[model samples]
Target: MNLQPDARRALGAGLVVIALVAFSNSSAHISDVGQQAAVAAVSSTDTLTQLNQSLISANKDKGVLKEGELLEKAVHRKALMEILAKENPAHFLRYVLNASQISSLPKSVTATVEKRISTEGVIDTYIIDDFEHPEKSHYEYYFKRGANVKSLYLVGDLLVRSNTQALITGYEGDTYVVADNTKGNVTIKANKDIDGGSNEALGVQNTAVILVDFDDSGPRPFTKEQAKNIFFNAQFNKFMKEQSYNKVSFKGDVYGWYRLSGPSMSNGQHVIPVFGNDNSQLNRIILENNIPIGNYGRVIIAINSDFTSSSQVGMTMQYIGGREYFFSSSWISLAGFDILAPFPFTWTDLDFLLAHELGHALGLMHANSWECG
Candidate 1:
């Protein structure tokens, strides 16, 4: 989706940069602050007007929605946001439920998540949704379940986003370990550490993923230079060995890295990395381009740095896991941490972030305290 340069700048500045704590080989926790958007809140009426204009532009560009129909939907969405805000507003980790889907869901879940969803966890009731899409509005995020036959509600995202300190929660096969105890807090621990191919990890196991980025001529977010240092650094590989009590060491070669340029990384709806196991647009592109897929895991990392052409959500990573490491992968921003961090940052912090996420992908759950239980 193309965004005008001016508009991207305007929104990116306000999009919250959620800074989270990355764990060590063990899920060591810490007191951390989310790098939230610094913009001042505008009146709801004015905010709705801007949203309405954007909705109109998006619909007109997509050439979808009947005359005034998109506006009606936007009005409904704005109203829903208001109602949801009253229920609990304070937007961060922004989310909005599909009105239609909500009605259809079993009463048990709708009752639970509807009451729990919010933007910033202030119980301020602010939630967000991309309702302009004719069919695939962001509101209806879903993932495949048994036998990969169909997509089911990623109700977990809603549940976690809606509630606080949501730890040890698993949906489908993926688990949510909000180890840090903060809103938008996430850590991935997969059980496939010991058995690289097994869906779950017995002890400490080995896992692999294809981490790639677009070869944009502009500055890179995480340069191949920087990625190599993080991925192949003596300490990084050493850290992996240490994670398994020196049993499962990645002497290198556990993951492959590539950079692609051109339209392959351009098509498809943008995917915001999340804690669930949904295949992203870049993953599809990788498949079409014949990138080898892993048996135990499959994911293509696309480092999107084009603020002028991208929707700016702070740094995020997504995975799909059930059992042990059925399939898990992630896409991360090049400069998300650098841009979001309030303190001076370096690769060490970034390395820990990777380590922490790996811990989650391998089936570990978060602890209420500083430990990874």
Candidate 2:
């Protein structure tokens, strides 16, 4: 039909207006409903949650959001994470958007970022892990690198996205170098050092001697060789190097083993064993004159079968300056090996017990779970 131009334009305009009205009405309703759902879901608790978000928003520190303004309890938790989206978008973008857990993950590793990278954008998923000690006898872990992950911390290992130029800075209490990353994977264990210099990262490069002097009055379970082997094993050597003494790293050397010859040495302790001692003593002693205390920083371990941990297991102590430092050990000879009892013991256990004593000598307290973890 031949119609006037103005009439045709007017008809189109009317239809456009009707469509605009419908869209605006629908959008307003949707937005209002979405906001209401969010408030209702979050208001159940006075505390806001740790965010689990999209790849771009994951790991960003959202300061503690307080729901106390409208929530049931009307109380706020401490503001823990304060990160600005504008200041560091890298962190902001990594903030968690969603989170969930699975029974299959290992406790040693904290979290994982699953990302598939392509030229267009990123598709990321995250899994929150269980940190409580494991219930299983053996567990497995897998380290997978993707575009979204920057750094991840495990029990004793740290995985960073970049693998190049991976040099270990000094590692001390509760920190270790699993793999120097020079060649490949490494085992994780306590008392293991993250040495900056050694190829194995085992510990100090040089060796310092700790001479053991046995008393003639007691039974000796270990021949000089056996005692030396116990203290010089990989575990003991690595543990010693990983430690700090006098506010400095025990960085210079591994402990050397020596057996004093000729006469048996006199035991120095204000207290006695079995009746009132725990297979241990103070690290420093007032030496009986006429006895030679070799070079400064030298430690002499005097072992006597007569000494016992009040007939139980363990004890430890520390000392002050040189004229030589000495420590005493009490033990019962067990089938070819000198042992600490009150429980089943092994060479590894012995290493741990003695290293703990060394820590006492170095002025460290017996660390509880809180401190070590």
Best by TM-score: 1
Candidate 2 lDDT tens digits, 1-373: 2222232222222212221211222221223332443454443222334322211122233223232321221111111111111122122223322234312222221123222111111111111111122111111112222222222222222222112123222111111111122223223221211222112211232223233333343444455555555555645455454332111223222222223333432456322321111212222222322223232232324344233211111111112223222222222212223443344533343453444433332322222222111
What is the overall TM-score of model 2 with all chains considered together? 0.25
Off by over 4 Å in 1: 1-199, 202-206, 209-211, 214-233, 251-280, 298-325, 332-350, 365-368, 371-373
10 residues in a row with least lDDT, candidate 1: 118-127
- The total number of steric clashes, by the backbone 3 Å criterion, in model 2 comes to 21
Q: In model 2, what is the error at residue 179, expressed in angstroms?
A: 51
Model 1 Cα shift for residue 61 (angstroms): 38
Q: What's model 1's lDDT at 151?
A: 20
After TM-score superposition, the amount by which residue 7's alpha carbon in candidate 2 deviates from its true location, in angstroms, is 89
| CA lDDT of every candidate | 0.33, 0.26
Give the number of the best model, judged by lDDT.
1
Clashes of each: 40, 21
Badly placed stretches (over 4 Å) of model 2 are: 1-218, 242-298, 306-349
TM-score of every candidate = 0.39, 0.25
